[model samples]
Target chain A: MYNDIIIENFSDPQHVGDLESADIELEVGNSVCGDRIRVQILLDDNKISNALFRAWGCATSVATANIFCDSLLNQSLDSVCQRDVEYKQQMLGELSPSQHHCMDILNELHQLLSEQRVAEDVANG
Target chain B: MDRQQLAGYFDYNATTPVSPAVAEAMTATLGQFANASSNHAEAIRNRNAMQQARVSVAEMLGTSADKVFFTSGGSEANNWAIKGRLFNHLNKPGHIITTAIEHPSVLETVRYFEKQFGFKVSYLKPQSNGAISISDFMAALQEDTQLVSMMYANNETGVIQPISEVAKITSARGIKLHVDGVQLVGKRAIDVEACDIDYLSFSAHKFYGPKGVGGLYIKENNSLSPLIHGGGQELGLRSGTENLLAISGLAKAAEEAKCAIAQWDQHAQACKHLMVDLIQQADISVEFNGDTTYANALSNTLNMAIKGVRGEALAVLMDKKHGFIISIGSACSNNKQKTLSAVLLAMGLDEERIQSSIRVSFGQYTTTADIENFVTALNQCVKQLSAMSFAS
Candidate 1:
């Protein structure tokens, strides 16, 4: 049972393609349900510019990947990394009990993105 | 919205739409006020309903009416077949031989017997084509084996088993054979006596009948202990008052199925071939999951793994956007999503292929136009989902 937002995004996902010019390519999956989400982001001056995704799983998870990538466009990398994990969990909007696992996929995608930034910060220092 | 509003529907194995005749029969029986077990003159209507229903069910099963016992549905019929046979022999050491790809009702029942009653079980793994090899079953046969439980056709892949061969062996050796014929009934002809099946299970809903009414056929000499001890209904094999309304519905369905079986088989075969032809003509890359040859499988079911797309996502796009309804695996096994199908997994399918596999089963209601429209919708959905998947 998906909400309107899920049905809308799942029907026609905009950011569902590979970005060849990406600065960071991150992939996360839920081994339980076999949901895989790969995100490719292009960074400009430590800010997100272009974001695209490739996903395989339920409709909710596929839509979540698109929605997550949409939220990252033109935002400073530091701000997203600083965003609370709790806030990131609900950023995908309301999910039913069955669709709740997509939140974990989103969080994992965010965590992978943050881990990449943390590594860059350490290397620069 | 109902299925009539959907763009396409191919999930007949899940449950068929109740036929109009079955509904009318059930409606007519609702006023049978007396209990089926009661012997008063006022009870004759209900009692006659149950008796006539039993006759029809037995005729459908190719058995005498005396051997038919009514239960709630396939699961209960299966439970009664397994536990009814093994419940009394728990203390004794015995062996059970069943396929790894059986419905959960039979699979879990045998597993429980092995763990709770110390009975040894041999789970016969399916061949790569999702078929149980006769040699493997022969190896599992033993002197101490008590019962062999297997399905007549797989619920997911629809691969027909070698029931006659196994029946010959088991009957000669005095071993009881319980066939879960839930999917095979009405779709194919069954002869329990000729096939030497000791216990056979079937459900009404599987054959365009009402739900909650199923029957089991026990051989004349083979007796199973009662699962429910109450007023001795169902020849004292299963207890409690019969659902007279549902029984009348099942009888009407059974009578209709006797004449419609061959016709259904023919129509379903045409639809199945049309689906395959459209997929090939569209240049869709898919691996047929089960045996494609009609000799080894049912003509109605076609399980395929579409390359570069997940089955669940494809099903979702078809259901939501295109209003198509299909299924990935057995509809009853959706409670646990973490695991892939034990049926396909037992057939040595890779996890990725198993995850991408979707089952498209046809029925008497399916038409050539429905198949063409379904393939068109499926093609578009597959292309869209493929673009989003890494496999593309």
Candidate 2:
């Protein structure tokens, strides 16, 4: 069962689809459950200017992706990287044990974004 | 407004609201405080009520009263049948043949026997039409096979299996056959004598009766070891104190269903036709899951897949936004797992189809207006979810 907030977010996901000319794009999926999430981010002066996601999976994964992207907007990459699975779980209250993998998708996205940032810095240097 | 009051119920396969007749019967029997096993006068009255309930159930199944054994519910009855048959030959665990789409009661019980005990099981996968082939069943039969269990109708797809044909094969082979009739008992008439079913399991709640009450029909001369050991109730096959109140309700419900079978069938067929027609008119890219011909499926159930939109999300949107209630799959598997429906997958449906499929079922009380409203709401939900999923 999902909480009211999760349902609301899933039904009307705020930021969805790809952002063309974006700074970074990341795609991740769980083969076991077949949930896939693709996140595109735009950077402005080292801060996240925009973040959008496209998800094809269960309610939790889709809702969590939207909520994660919504939280990333206007925040610096350091703060986005600091936000862990627990933070997202708190945002969407009381996910069942079976649905906890939704947060795993967020973690995977963060790892991808961090790796992309490091690769960009090395290239620029 | 409360969602319970406004929502259109399309999940009859999960459970039914107790009919007023069944409620009144249960209320009247609730005051009977005596134990049914005692020899006192009050106990005699309680015993009489149990026997009457048994007779009503047997009548519905077209079997004799003595052949029926009451259990907690369909799950318990299924467990009793599978475990009891295996335990009958305690030292020798032979082979079991069943379908992959059976309810967890049968699937899990067989799994336990295979893992904990030494029973070998052959799970027959359904064809794309959602029916198991009789030839495949015949081929799976082995010399050491002792029992075969298959459902009369699937809970998710409502696809009816050819149990009568399998029955003839098992009977001729001298192997015991058990039918999980939980989904079929009230939707259609079952003549145990005609079908030659050795054991059958049924639950009352699926037919407007009270929950926690069901019965198992055992053919004459067949014996099963007791699953619950005590009190010697249910002819010692299932031992526990009788649930007099629920049994009375079950009997009343069974009687009502028997009397109204033809009318109910017609109403359900009409509702299904109307819903399908309305869905077609909306021009949604939809694929009806399972046997859409109604020749092999129940009249009341319709499973469909809307391209691109997620089934679970659509179910939530329909319930939360539109006051419509339907199911993404079997109620038993809804909240427990995140995987696509195993029933659809076993029918050779791809992942997208499985994820987008929703099951809708109706009952005697469902009206034409209810079907119209459900289709309208479904059309809107599909359009909205499709936009959100496919938008750039």
Cα RMSDs, all models:
2.6, 2.9
lDDT of 1 at B170: 93
Q: What lDDT would each prediction earn against the true structure? A: 0.85, 0.85
Write down the TM-score of every candidate: 0.94, 0.92
Name the runs in model 1 displaced over 4 angstroms.
Answer: A31-34, A43-47, A94-101, A118-125, B1-7, B329-337
Q: Give the per-residue lDDT of model 2 (tens digit) for B325-361.
A: 8899421122335566878889999877888899999
lDDT of 1 by residue, B109-162 (tens): 889888877999999999998889999999888889999998999888989999
TM value for model 2? 0.92
lDDT, candidate 1, residue B274? 86
TM-score evaluated only on chain B, model 2:
0.96
In Å, candidate 1's interface RMSD is 3.7
